[model samples]
Target: MKKLLLLSISLIISGCASFGEGVTTAFLNKQKEKDLRECRVDGKSFGGMQGNYDGSNNLLKVLMVHGVGTHIPGYSTQFQEKLAAELGLDEMSSHYKEIKLVNKEYPDQDLGVLRVRRLLDQEQDEEMLFYELTWSSITNPQKEKLAYDTSGEYSFRRAEVNQMLKVFSNDTSPDPMIYLGKHSQDVILASFRTAFCWMMGRDWDALPNESQELCTVGQTAVEHLPDEDFAIISHSLGSRIVMDGMKSMASRVSKAQEGEPTSTEAAFITDFQKKRTPFYLMSNQLPLLDEAAIAEKNSASLKFKV
Candidate 1:
């Protein structure tokens, strides 16, 4: 019964067409609350990005990371549009830039893609570059193992609602499992790293458009680290990735700072820490996804009246 309730909730959230509109509306109306959810922010307060763009000298850059489930490069389109409107960014570049995230050592691996859009005010003075990272491709191959179970050959045997639940399950259930794998975790983090590198490396004009090339930090990329501001917007499991990725980078930066090295990598890592980039996480599950014990389940038996 609990599992069925969870599946029903998922169906409602997914806006499955088969769900009765009247029932969906009632459920959503109940959820559209009188401010019942408590939000507690545990960090230093920061300013908004309204006027952060200061001509050519300073640039406001925002990177977005998605959560569990399959996502395409343009998944953040609606959000971006709304954000732009709020910021009074009435104009944008004719074409957005796209870069394929790749690691030099793992050339054959399809890490993911980064889509970048440049937004500007009517005066073309205030500007922001929004980067959307789509890393689902990295885990899609592993999820293909469940393909047969979701196929019509098997799905036809189940009830309609059950089949829908199974399809949704097959789509999202494997992500955290796949992320738990050592190799896949490393690869996903690598994808995030690549996206960060690209965000740091270039401006709108300097960025590569539609390419599967890897980004290198280089001397020049590190030089601009101080002039740029970065923020991350992430949802659900993506919040975990962002947290883990930042911790990993911060650890490296801390080590490099201790050594006081002069290499490009060392310089970049040290400066990257100075940015103090903020993360605005939505539907975050970081508390639930403890890296050390994510797979551990409570051994105690539940006492339920059957």
Candidate 2:
């Protein structure tokens, strides 16, 4: 029952539409205002993911991650608004700034921004960047349609959903572990690609020359770190990405220290988060009843990582 409720809440949040007249833009494929509407219609729920990057180099950075279900780009914007309200920051005073890296490495793409309520210290200094990872591309409606028509990796027929439910219900008619694993992995990989690119300083829609190609992202990761402090906010599945990304970047740096000739961009990945970084996780499903023990696995996986 708790699991069902949590799923319902996520759906409700993702489905809510708040259409403001803010400019819609991104790198590699920045669109005009009219194009923004067209693209939104094309993707059905995807409002377009942006890096929320401005030209100025602000130091403190925060990454927001979203979890399961089909989500639109509006999710990020809405989350920012609410976050601002809760923190007693004035949203009207701030605005969204779309940035496009104009070098040969990044493709033209769509980017969005939510410059909301900044946190001010006693020194009256305002410095912190909040980046929301619009990785809903994995659960996007149009993308799902394409994936289903091409390869059935993430497509779930009625029977498949039932089978998955059986696993949740402890039905032993057939072991659905493999089925669940494949679907889960498929979604995770899709999201990982999106999140990884954004973190590595590439646009979310960045097309790599090779599928295995990974950019040295440390410098890019710290580009906006105006201060040594950082924080992360995760909803649902985003927690996994934050933990995994931290580990992935950390491993890269450690390898370099071992004389493995790691990419120069690898040194500062963990450094990006070590300074006074705090994580605020919302809509977390762990406390909800998870019969399959997925929550326990998440707990273990999150252990012992900065």
Candidate 3:
């Protein structure tokens, strides 16, 4: 009798659009507006993922990693708004000049300004930096479509990829490329070539190997910035990227510090104290893998609500 009653309730709940729906449209719309306001006030592009430095004497940095097939600008923008609100940096604005967009494809891109919300002492200036790692193949629509098609799930993947790209671009401009659904490896490679051409000032043929390519991009950005207190935030597939990147970083730092007395890497390590670098995974569906391995890997920090 109890099981039958539960089944009846489930049927009624499933028929409604409200039950089990994650992040309502109304809420998303409001979040969009709030994100724009934060971006404008901070003088940062909504989609900027990596390396935003607020002008100040004190130094802190943040790296935001996006899941597979997502870019920096769109993904970073949403999270930045949330972080700003949480840090109480909403109203403060410094006189520092904003970074300009040099890439024509991404006209809205900018180096973000950090607004200090709290200070441990009045004599100190607090600074923050934001960095992003956007996969090459996912940056361009043509490439994403091709990857989706090559994966043998073109229709579903294309729609998902396009929607994500639109969100990242934050451009309402109509895209005619929406209809070309049949993707191929060649197509994906070509799309990546275009985006990388703009970013690295080189042709698609000159691109580096997959592992080296992503690691170089991420590490280069990290190296260029002021090595100060830093935190990492990754979502969805980004969690995987961040894990890999951090592993690479740890290895590099360890090797470089061989037989040397230094605390540089230590500072970076301390900054990522569990409380500071909190990893939040939303709507995560693990890829084909054993449940035991997943549990073993993330047992310490994993929190499963459902």
Give each model a TM-score.
0.79, 0.44, 0.36
CA lDDT, every prediction?
0.83, 0.44, 0.39
List ranges where model 3 is wrong by over 4 Å.
1-59, 91-127, 136-227, 257-306
How well is each residue in 1-306 modelled by candidate 3, as lDDT tens digits? 999999999889875656436547667777767444343345544423223234232444454444444343334555655666555445322321121112333334321121112212233343343334344323354444444333444445567777566445432111112211223222322322222222221211222322111212333332323433445565554454444445554565567556452464444333332222334444443352135345555776978788
Clashing pairs in 1: none
- Please give, for residues 104-210, the per-residue lDDT of candidate 2 as tens digits: 22333222222222333333333444555555443343233333332344334447666555333332211213213544434443344344444334332332322
**Top-lDDT candidate index:** 1
Superposed by TM-score, candidate 2 places the C-alpha of residue 273 at a distance from the truth, in angstroms, of 7.8
Q: Poorest 10 consecutive residues of model 3 by lDDT? A: 171-180
Q: How close is candidate 2 to the true structure, as a TM-score?
A: 0.44
Q: Which stretches of candidate 2 lie over 4 Å from their true place?
A: 1-59, 91-95, 98-124, 141-226, 262-276, 286-306
